[model samples]
Target: MVNFTHQDQGTSASCWQQAGLEQIAALDPEKLFHAMASVIVLAAHPDDETLGAGGLIRMALGQGTDVHVIVCSFGEASHPDSTTHSAAQLAALRHAELAEAMDMLRAQGPRSGTLHLHCLGLDDGKLAAQQEPIRAALEQHAGERCLIASTYRGDGHPDHEILGLLAADCALAHNACHLEFPIWFWHWAQPDRQPSFRHWFRLALDASSTDAKARALEAHRSQTTPLSALPGDEVLLSEGFLQHFSRGAEIFRATWPGHRDAASAPAVFDELYGEREDPWEYRSSRYERRKQQILLACLPQERYAAVLELGCSIGVQSAELARRSTRLLAVDASATALAQARRAVAGMDHVELLQATVPRQFPQLEPGSLQLVVLSEMGYFLAADELEQVLAASAAALQAGGELVVCHWLHPIEGWPLDGEEVHRMAGQLGWERIVEHREADFLLEILRKPAGAHG
Candidate 1:
């Protein structure tokens, strides 16, 4: 069962006080102090700002730092208490709810303050309709030096995904920093399938901040009850945000754009998503089977000095990797999944479990010491350019002629920056020489060798 910080002692408005216990482990003092400067929260709706970054905003305000909120919509059509209400009425109530939420967030104890709130007045669900204006708002406010926080595409919310894309564009246009926080869409996006390392910001809310967060979330009483009702929902003891730094020029990925054909990517989900006792059973069932097949096909039947597998969800693949490598580092973002992985691979002496995200450069890892880097079912989560950085970082992590593997699920995701095929094409652009390419009925796997003479 998923563990969450439960807040039964207080009203629903104060539930957020318990939201961060899991997230606090990810934060350190250095990261918290870094976030004290300018902070920006880009929300698809008013409640989102509170849901995702309320603790961080409160921290910024407490430190007398600048904090800005950009709300894409007034959430005119969202109201959990009024099923019989019309859209117009719902909009009115949501707007009022947002005003109250903002007050609770910025105001002391029970009063609202004059914190800056920017609203685009876009249609709540039809965020794509207001893309132009949304883009402009993000670009205008995302000046250099500001730390911006937005939603991740995996949240399974359309508006939130668009906001993520818009935030990426703003980061590119103004060269600012940006992060993605998971929110309500966690209802549908499976826990094991979500991106682990993409969130760059790691923040912890203290006990007092937790109290303020609960009160701030409680202020949106109409929204919280329903959100908390979603499957596996739990109030957190602490809350935080995640960030993925940009690699180069911002790469915009849209199915609507005629970028490149993603026809060649693998569709792993279609083959494995059957009714199972554990929703994440595929990690052990079909996922493990396929990963074994890919490892056997790509890796030599010999031992290696070192190997790194980023986003190694359940160590299904990492176990097989352990047999072929001397030392293996497996990292994921979910502590629960990592715990399960630790148990699954407990007997393997050469494996290490870590909590981290992809598109992240593990500079501390022994550079030029690793022989192989495997990224499976993890590439599609990032924007196009970010994938390139992951490849570069993998190259840096490896010695000359080191091996790098690329694998991603091919089925169409609603708002991914690029499909699996586009990610592979970008990998080809890197200096690595292609070694083996496997095309099966379900997935695509490619192995590339770093040049011995040229630096990766």
Candidate 2:
């Protein structure tokens, strides 16, 4: 099990002080609950839902709104040092604790009989590998005009982060509002240093609701106190940790509206290719042909050691890029596009094609290893925050003085959240030196060099 108790007491104290230095804006509970058709809570562990949003859940239920709770794990590995109990025994105890916690929450609400609960029973500490199954389960329960709540992605836990990403995707797919609550973030994150992209609001709880939340938290006996009589066993939820949650209100942040869903861009291309093999006419258009030549000619070096071509649809650009690169790895999200790309580049031994979704399943390149990267006609497919992540990844993988070339259409597509200019504007903010910028009536092309000694 991961040892969260090892966190330095001094640093935790500093974080707690910073957390309360500035008060977060208040969110009106009546306005929030009245607008939601339903609510879905995704908890990475047994007590996460209670620790983060217990009061919010009570208010929603008391208002007679339908609510669904999905607990992803039974938290079997939390007390790995215990000598009196096996992992199975700990898991069984955690399950019972969760049931009791839910009963305590429901007892405080008016419509206590209507809340639905699901225990996935997934193994603790391994949720990152099981994203697909968890995502499918969340999608089944999510619906339009609903509110989805999950732990914040930056909550300092692996399971919580992955589930937060999955919850954002599900919320976007169902057109629901996504709210993220902070759990461990309060123990480490400094309030003033939070990222500019994050917006936060606190759900104010009255004295009665605060007391109810405290009682609900007390139901998880295994976490709040010592779990076993073994010599090494200790309380997982220390007094320092519980102090962060003792406030009268709980803090919630927004995620999906600013971050694009992983499936949204891929789904658009999938449907477009379903109708025709070449949706953008990369093979036959004179404009595309000239654009490709301009992109190739703008390279600073005559030849690159290795190159990555993101969104290499049908290998049209990959075939030309392969000649200039000793080794080329081309990637796209659509399997249909990759099938054609595989056939198109079959004769080239130096080229490799892989199907991967961006900002999620990127190539694991060694730090500062890649010599060049090409992003062509694909930036608009991502949201502002998603594009930022891709840019950061590219910066991390690029060698010192490595080149990044971007070619995007000037106009906006009907369903895309970002336009070509917006994508280029965000890239400009990454502090890379602009080496070459070519503008045309139809498209915009730019080449940026990674500054020497810079890291992503």
Best-fitting candidate, scored by TM-score: 2
lDDT of 2 by residue, 1-456 (tens): 113443445135346445552365678888888787788999999889998988888778777787899999998888776887778998999899998888777744446436788999888989999887798889888876788999876577889888887887787777677888878776655444433223367788876668778888999998888876666567888887887777777878654343444445566567778889998899889998999999888888889999999999889899888889899999998888888898888889999898887865778889888999998888877655457668878888899899899889997565557788888888897788999999998889999999988755
Per-prediction TM-score: 0.47, 0.80
Tell me the tens digit of each residue's lDDT in model 1 across 176-225.
Answer: 55666756433332222222323233465665555666676667654555
Q: Provide the lDDT at 454 for model 1.
A: 52
Question: For each candidate, how many residue pairs have backbone atoms clashing (under 3 Å)?
Answer: 24, 0
Question: Would you list the C-alpha lDDT of every candidate in the order shown?
Answer: 0.60, 0.80
RMSD of 1: 17.4
